[model samples]
Target chain A: MRAVLDEVRFLAFDVFGTVVDWRSSIARAAEPFLTGHGIEVDPLVFADEWRSRYQPSMEAVRTGVRPWVPLERLNRESLETVLARHGVDFGAVTGDELAELNRAWTRLDPWPDSVVGLTRLQRRFPIGPLSNGSIAGMLALARFGGLPWNVILGAEIAHNYKPMPQTYLRSVEAVGLRPDQVAMVAAHNADLRAARAVGLRTVFVARPLEFGPGQTADLTAEDDWDLVTGSITEVADLLGC
Target chain B: MRAVLDEVRFLAFDVFGTVVDWRSSIARAAEPFLTGHGIEVDPLVFADEWRSRYQPSMEAVRTGVRPWVPLERLNRESLETVLARHGVDFGAVTGDELAELNRAWTRLDPWPDSVVGLTRLQRRFPIGPLSNGSIAGMLALARFGGLPWNVILGAEIAHNYKPMPQTYLRSVEAVGLRPDQVAMVAAHNADLRAARAVGLRTVFVARPLEFGPGQTADLTAEDDWDLVTGSITEVADLLGC
Candidate 1:
């Protein structure tokens, strides 16, 4: 931890499942929107399907199979597909309404310790979200959830999504910090590994409930992270900020 | 103003002169850094020269004379040149120290009415700075001045500085609003003209003290702006939001 403090100047966060309870938040947001039309569907199943489509949709842009679209558009496209599969018709959902519902991703509830931990860490180092989400989406989430980020940065600025070196590099450059001076904090092993590969410090904060009840992975740190803590609060305590 | 209020969903602001007192802020920040070093340069002159270099430096990038560089880097390079010309030697200024000094742009003091005006406008529109400053720089200004911005959009994201259509378009796109749905509120006629060319609504808020007395321009609407108000508060009152 002292080693981390010595080198890390910026703390970049991974927003979705790492800092926020996306599964629960998405389910909660979608329930009312879905049930309002008398559409009877399992909200959890709907959320899982929504999450499932995220990667492939991003991959389409990453692989150049589709043009770069904002996360809101991609989410809406995926939502429509998922609802259609559940026998829900698009005739009831206008484009504007669908766009608003798709923005549910922007209002996810942070983990109980997330905001408090980030606020503490921010006192010592510049802290902001470094995620695959669009800057607009992240900003909306910050405003809605009161996430006190010094700045909001994401893949939209880099034109490349997470696990990509450009995504991490673009964030570091945006803050005028060297790669080695920025630390990537996340619950995802892949994200931390990518960040480390690009010469950034890494801190692992385990979110055991990240994947819901059936979660089997990411329950503990899988690699030698510079700092490992049970929660963002523990990480903040370890950092002594 | 009523016509604009009915359609405007986003408001992009110019940072330095429009929302903040840049000359005073820059002079104040540079004073302590330069004192007792046998470098008795006029802080006001330093501030003016520093700002004077901004447009030309950005023009170098815009015209392809220089590669794309963040505003912080541009500020550093220009600062070094300007200080050398002023016969001030700062052999003691380390790279880190110089970088921190460059961030003075981020911590500028807001205009007396900026905070109150922006707060009222934020209730009705998604308000943020649309400037040539970097995201980190704008975020710092917002935090230090208590500016309530829903997002911070800058040239770093657009890769083009203002007076360019991309700057205005990018701000609108970042907020998921069309050009016509956004309003560009600024003290500069050129900025408003650029925004107007792109179909954005425009409002001119006079900043008589922007140039610190003997100001010759931007004291009144130059073009047929959608709304002209004596101050940002007046603009807010006119918008009724």
Candidate 2:
């Protein structure tokens, strides 16, 4: 592990669950949106329904069932379905309002330790997101959450979604670093698995409550990831940052 | 001017001669390499010769004479020619050494006003480079000079060199901004001209010493750019940042 840490030059992050609390953030944003439209629906359930569509939407692009589209488009499309499920009339919501509500993903709040941990790690390495988020969406999220990044790296930059080899390889290539020289930091075992499969070092940080109090998966390291900790700050400490 | 400012949500910069003083930076990097290699050459002249090839090399890709390539590749190829001109045998230099020296562009020094001005402007808007440099190169430059940027934008992200409509338009699109909502800032009139043609607002900051004391071109604004100033600090002031 020491030897591996010695060779790592950059760190790429999984943004959604690892760094930011998207479930509650989305629920918070959805509550106001639902009330404004005179609709009655559980905001948390709405958030879950909207998020449940995320993977299927990306799978369409990954499987070549559809052309590449930014996550913003996918989010908007999923939002319509979520709203329709509550028997809400789409015409009641203005385009501008929908766009603003869709941006709830961008306005997500960072985990308590994310900023401090990232800031500490950044002192030793260049850090950026390597998520499925588009560059624009990541940029907005960074601004909203005050994520101190040295660069933006991710799916949009590679024109592919996460778990794809292109997303991992192209992002590594963009920073002029080999896969071994970069570390993919995430809270999900599957994300680390995909990154490790591509020769990138992987660090798993526990995001047990990411899906809420009833979360049943990804509560602990699932395999021999490069590093595993309870929070990003713990990861930073282990890295001597 | 106020109307233009109100519309501008982001600011993109021309980096080489505008944000960073590439002439002296390249010359400084060249001096040590030449001395270490037991070669005799005027560093500044070598810098000028290398820069002279920049446009022509980019022109190849822009005109379809060659496929798209990063500025780092172009700089390296140009470096080989410059070294050969100075009677240095390519075989004598190690590949690693050549790569380190080619990264001279990444270690450029920012103009005196750049950091302060950019920090001020960044408080009000997201700022980034829209130069022809690769994302890795721009990332290094930002780290080297401590440039405060919300995102890294430019040629590599767009996969096209500047002065091309795709370069400007794609960068704007990546930030989810329209042409009118972004300002292209530079020291070169040609860069501003190209940007303005694409409907982006332009801000010209004087860089009379960019080519040293004898500089005769771009000493002053060549046309009515959206805003013109002696330094980025003044531009920040004008924008009420």
Candidate 3:
């Protein structure tokens, strides 16, 4: 805690798996929609499949194989593909329905410690979500989860996704803080590595359930982060907040 | 009030005068700095002069007289000009000092009713500050004033100044709402008029002391805004929230 309090000023959090239980949220929300259409599918498998499309979709945009598209659009496209692969054809989904489905990302349930931990951290430092989601997405998620962020920041502001230096830098810029003054908090080693490479501090909070029961990776810290905490609340306590 | 409620799904607010009392906040903060330097100037006049530079600086960008510069840079440039005009040149003032002075915009005091009013409004509609300030500026102000904005939309995002249709439209787009579904709530008549011209709903909240005791303008509604009230709290009550 003293170590973190000594160096970190602003705490920038990765929104998806780090702060919110995205897999469960999506699975829960999609279950009703899928079941309502008389489709039989394993909700967890569906959640994992949906999340599996995320990296490839982002890679497509980054590699210029696809034009720059928002995460909502990518989610919808990938959702359709996943549903089709499962031998379930809901005919065609309307744009409005697609939009509502895409918003499942915004309605994610926060990990139990997220709200209380972030609220504690917010008392001492500027806190914001640094995610690949759009500003609108982060804002909605924050409102839904009561994730007391001082600001919403994401790829939409930078027009670049994470592991990209610009995404982290844009969050720092938005908070009017120097890169060194901001700390990136995430459960993923790659995110912390990227943040550290750009001179920002990093905190590792283990999210063992991020990928669910069969998760094999990101269960332990892979790099030397500024601080290691079991939960966001632990991070807040360590930071003396 | 009913008319505004019927069409408005989002409420965009003007920050400086509508949401926060910049004149008082700036004057209060600047007084200590000025006094420490043995520079006794009319703090109110100095604050007004500082604010008086805002629109023109933005106009310089809007009219293509200057390239798009962040609000911080614009404020710094205007501060130098204003200081020079006041004949109080502090040759020893460092860049850091000027930077701090520029950030006075971010620490403005909110009206007593702002937090409660905005929180109430946020229950039903997306609420944010749509100002000529930068995203960082708005975020910092929100933190300092405890303004409960769901999002921060500023000229930095729009790349344009108020009274321009793009400013209003960009804010609406950022919130994923149609123009008519958004309401521009401002103390300034010109802002509401511009927003209304772009097919947005409008609300006029009169800030009688915005310009201090001798000021004559913005004491009453100039246009037939969808809603008019003496305070933002009143406006919130009228909205039935």
Candidate 4:
């Protein structure tokens, strides 16, 4: 067992790229939608554009420009904007169809090591996702990907999005553990930095392909996190699971 | 699959009696403490009294007489009150010891059919506990009993107790489903009634021995629930899981 994890009672994860291959999954789901609409756009570019809207939308909540709505609503608004910007005709889509497509965030496929690693880690400590994704969205994603999170926590419960102090603080408190007793395992260095700033131990896992072949942002850790690994399974091994 | 369940995407459960045998579990844990303190009270009776305080304490939150606090704190306060009434000397116990004893709720054993039944049900629909237990308390109990809940909801999320409209409403909403799309499966008629009143469908499972040999309350369904069964396993069967 690593001495660092000796006091850790819970291992909280960042869901999007850390647990699920969001880019690829989103691209795959959007391809048929784009092709059926006769849009001459690469599905990967569409996925990138849709995901780029995530931060600005969440920023509206963090900055109090919007009230706390579940990420599902924000996701839909962002999706609609992206579709219109990309010249895709969503006029053919019913509200129900648009809503179903907005749930693409909940239909992600997990990175290969996520499920097995999380299962191993769960045997020794409570494991859960601390995503900016709404509790409902995470639950749907878990059901879809077989992610074994012990409890759902984060934005939905905190009423605040990620990189905000409340999101990390509230999640740790929800798990009934102090910040020092819970480790935040995330693929993004900025996320790890935010978590560490609030006294949580941070583990950095690399997902070079998280943003696809032309990925630029978060290509590698910007700082030395408490534990840096190539895969979540390595995280399990380090935790002595 | 039952046609009635065609729209239902989730089944939220009541944890204490409906999922775990809390009465027996509490009694078993308290017996040693009572015996060590030279108390003459029947442990089962003590368990009943402790459980009886549950609602009133929760009512304080529901009625806003008390600010939102986790059930674990309420449980400890209730335990101390019961201990004093029975003349159990706390002078012999340490603060740490009392806190440890307070977690008896987290150490509960599931009813024999709970794990198997929930496992089966989970294959078809997402299942979770919608208990007034604090999120931390429920998570610990789930780990202990090997209960498989897809998400954690209820009191911790709603910051309100059972029979309170928000508790049921928020749970259904938290599952990312409309009230009509999530069925509340419980052992108590009152719980089901509360759930149904909030537009959630209901399932009542009989647990005649929940309070041990002298159990009287909830011996049979008091109201017509959407589905009534004898065990959690039967609930799975009826749901075609």
Candidate 5:
């Protein structure tokens, strides 16, 4: 473990539910906007529905069924779908207003330990996002949440979503490092599994509350990851930062 | 000018001579290495010769004479050319040593006002480098120099060098902003002109010492840029940061 730690030169993180509390943050931003539009659905449910579309949407691009599209566009399209399913009159909302509401993804709040933990980790390694988020969205989220990333990597730059081998390989190459020299830190076993498959060292940080109460998935590390910890701060400690 | 500033949503900068004191930094790094190799040459002159190859080397790619290559590769090739011209024996250096020395470009020092001024500017805008430097090189330079950029943009991501339209246009698009809504901050008049020609608002920050005491160009703004300032701090003040 110490030898592997010694080889890690850069760290890239999964952003959405890992670094940021996207469920509550999206729910929080959706509440007022939905209420303003005379929509009566629970905002958390709305957030879930919006997020539930995330993987399937990317799967379309990953399978080459659809051309490459930015995650921002995917989020907005999913927003409209969720609104229509809730029986909201989409014609009443201005395009500008819809665009503003779709930007909620960029306003996510970080996990309590994210800023300080990443800052400490950054002293040892250059850190950035390795999520499916677009670079534009990542930039806004970094500013909104005070993420101490020195560079923004992954998705849009790779022109592919995560779980695709290219996403991990391309991002690692972008920083001029071999995969073994880079670590993928995430809350999901599947994300780490995919990264590890591509020669990237994997650290699984638990985010049990990412989906709120009754959350069942990703509650614990599903495999013997390189480092499995209860929080980003724990990951930092384990990495000797 | 005020209207243009109001519309600017992101700021991309030229890294080489705009943000860092590259000539002196390269010279400082080269002095010890060259002396150890028994090479009799002024380090600054070596730096100048290395930089002089930058444009012509990139022009090959810009004109499609060679397939795309990262700036790191270009820098190493230029280093070899400079060393051979000065009569250094190629057999003396190991590959690992050459690779380490080639990274001097990543170890540049920022100007006195850069860190503080950029920190202030970052408080208002999403700032990044839109240089010919590769993503790996830019990441290293940002870490080494303590640059307060929220994202790393430009060349490697765009797959083209500067003075090329796609470099500016693609970088702007990556951040989800139009050309008019992005500002190109640079010290070289030719670079600003290239950016402005592509509809990006231009700001010229003077770096008279970028080429050292005998600097003969870009000492003053050569055109009507959106903002022309003596320092990055002046740019921050003018932008109301």
Candidate 6:
């Protein structure tokens, strides 16, 4: 396993639910907006509701149902849809106000193990996010969370989201590695499956609470992944970093 | 100047000869090879000879004489050509050794003012290289130099070289900014002129010693730039970071 793993030179992460606790971060960031708008609802549920729309929105662009748009724009549209569904007042929210509210995705908090794991991993290999987030979105999140990414890769560069072959293939080339030299690190199985189909190594890190305490999806390794670990720090350990 | 620069959300640097003292760094990296092989060529001249071919090589790709190749591959090819012209024996150098030596660009030392200036500027905006260097090349240089870039941008993503319209246009979009919202910071007047032609604000941070103490080009701003400064630190100060 060590010999096989030694071939990997770049580790691209799935940012949102993988490196950062997006649910809590979104809930935390949205709390003020909810209060300002005089809406009464559980922030965590609101966060889940907003996140539930994430993939479908990206799918629209991926399938050509919509044009290529930055994740920030998609996030805003999703947020607006969620706000409307929740019957939240939109009368007082100005463009700037809504823009600030939309930045909830940018201010996400990194998982406790993220910094140390990534730092250790980066010492041996370049580590960065291969996320659905916009380049600006990833930049803001890195700045906010103090993520030590050597580079940012994913959506904006490929103009497509993952599970798509374009994103996977372009990511490998972007990092100056062939498909075999890169690994996709994620808490999601579907992402790993797609990356594996494109010839990338895969490491699945379990995040049972990614969607909140009651979360059940991606709770464990779903296949014989390259390396399945309980945390990213364990991933560092397994990678011999 | 302050008011105009204050609106810029990202600062994209030209890496070679701008942030790093490339001539010295490359010369230094080549010395052991020169000695070990009993070659007596001046390492500095070798560095110049290698760099002299830089644009012509890119021009081939840009003009479709060659397929899109990463800057690293171009560097190695240029190095091989220079080595052959200098009558250096390469039969003794293994493939791995040549590859390792090609990474000289990745280990360049930052100029005296580079880190301080970039660090200060990063406090106010996202900063990264918008160089012709490959993504892996930039990542290695950033890790070696402790550059605090929020992202890597440039030729690799654009699939075009600088002074080309695609590189400048794509760099802005990669950073999720409009043309006017991003600033192109470089030492070369031609670089700034190209950037400005595409509506990006330009700042010339003169590095007269970039080619060596006897450097003749870009010693002063060739035209009225958006801002002209003696050092990157001065650029940061003028930007009010």
Query: Which one wins on DockQ?
Result: 5
Q: Candidate 2 at B197: error in angstroms?
A: 0.5
Candidate 5 residue lDDT tens string, A1-241? 5677678999999999899999998899989988999998899988999999988879999988888999999989988988898898878988998898899999999999999999999987899999899998999899898898989899887888999999999999999999999999999999999999999998999999999897999999998888988888988888888
Which pairs clash in model 5? none
Question: Which model, 2 or 6, shows the larger lDDT?
Answer: 2
lDDT of 5 by residue, B12-31 (tens): 99989989999999999999
lDDT of 2 at A163: 91
lDDT tens digits, residue span B1-241, model 6 = 5577767888999989889999999999998988888778899988888899998889988887888899999999998888888686677777787788898989999999999999999888889899999888898898889787889999987888998988999989877789889899999999999999998989999998888889899999999888999888999888877
Better of 1 and 4 by lDDT: 4
The 0-to-1 C-alpha lDDT of every candidate, in the order given, reads: 0.83, 0.90, 0.84, 0.89, 0.91, 0.88
Docking class of 4: medium
> Chain A of model 5, TM-score against the native?
0.98
What lDDT score is found at residue B215 in candidate 3? 82
Q: Native-vs-model 5 lDDT?
A: 0.91
Model 4 residue A214 CA deviation in Å = 1.8
The residue-level lDDT of candidate 3 at B101 comes to: 80
* Model 2, C-alpha of B57: deviation from truth (Å): 0.9
Instruction: List, residue by residue over A1-241, the lDDT tens digit for candidate 1.
Output: 6665587878899989878999989999889888887777778877888898988878887777777777777887898888888787678778877877788898899999988988888777767889888877887788677777767776887787887788899888777778889889999998999999998899998888887888898888899999988888898899888
Number of clashing residue pairs, candidate 3: 1
Error of 6 at A161 (Å): 1.3
The DockQ of each candidate is 0.45, 0.74, 0.58, 0.77, 0.86, 0.62
Docking class of 2: medium
- Pick by TM-score: which candidate is best? 2
lDDT of 4 by residue, A25-130 (tens): 8888888778877878898888989999988889889988888998889889999998888676667877877777777888999999999999998888888889
Task: Tell how far residue A96 is off in model 1, in angstroms.
Answer: 5.3
The runs of at least 3 residues in candidate 4 whose Cα sits more than 4 Å from the true structure, single-residue gaps closed, are A88-90
TM-score per candidate: 0.86, 0.97, 0.94, 0.97, 0.97, 0.89
Candidate 1 residue A208 Cα shift, in angstroms, is 2.0
Pairs of residues clashing in candidate 1:
none
